[model samples]
Target: MTSITIDLSDSQFRKLQDFARVHGIAIEVLLKASLEDWLNLQKGDFVNTADYVLMKNAELYRRLA
Candidate 1:
């Protein structure tokens, strides 16, 4: 219902175009499917980036703990 603008790099644009052509779908339909999948990602199923970084560097945090 709403229009949005996005700019993709040449590589990204080419990849999307190729993928849509391979699947025999319109670019708009492919984009809508991608957006819906992203919107439906389970928030609780993935760790936040910062939390993941801290977890990876847990040795440095040992002193604080």
Candidate 2:
């Protein structure tokens, strides 16, 4: 596993800490889960966009091929 350091504003850190405490999870776990969710969302968005573009340009792509 690799570790990383990030700089957060005091308010942001406080907010995260508060949220984590309420959720009964550690800050590290909260961050990891949040990061994973965000990455998955981004991946899904990219795939959807790519599919849309490919479908929209299918005819052009076939002609070019």
Candidate 3:
């Protein structure tokens, strides 16, 4: 797998760290899970940012519908 670096504000980093500890997972693993969840939500089959964009870009998700 490839590795990359991102910069987060102190508050954001702390929130992620706290969630990681609460779920008993490493920060990296939690981040990956979060990404998957976000992608799933954005597929429009679920509620998310995609809900709004889906209506405007109906053709983009023709197969999905």
Question: What lDDT tens digits, residue by residue, belong to model 1 across residues 1-65?
Answer: 89999999999989999999999999889999988888767453465666788899999889878
For model 2, residues 10-36, the per-residue Cα lDDT tens digits are 999999999999999999999999999
Worst ten in a row by lDDT for model 2? 25-34
**What TM-score number comes out for model 2?**
0.90
Q: List the residue pairs that clash in candidate 2.
A: none
What would the TM-score be for candidate 1 when compared with the true structure? 0.62
**Clash count (model 3, backbone only):** 0
Candidate with top lDDT is 2
TM-score against truth, every candidate: 0.62, 0.90, 0.59
Which lDDT tens digits does candidate 3 get at residues 1-65? 88889999999999999999999999999999988898887675655665777787888779677
Give all candidate RMSDs, comma-separated. Answer: 5.9, 1.0, 7.1
Give the number of the best model, judged by TM-score.
2
Tell me which of candidates 1 and 2 scores higher on lDDT.
2
Candidate 3 residue 44 Cα shift, in angstroms, is 3.7
Off by over 4 Å in 3: 45-65
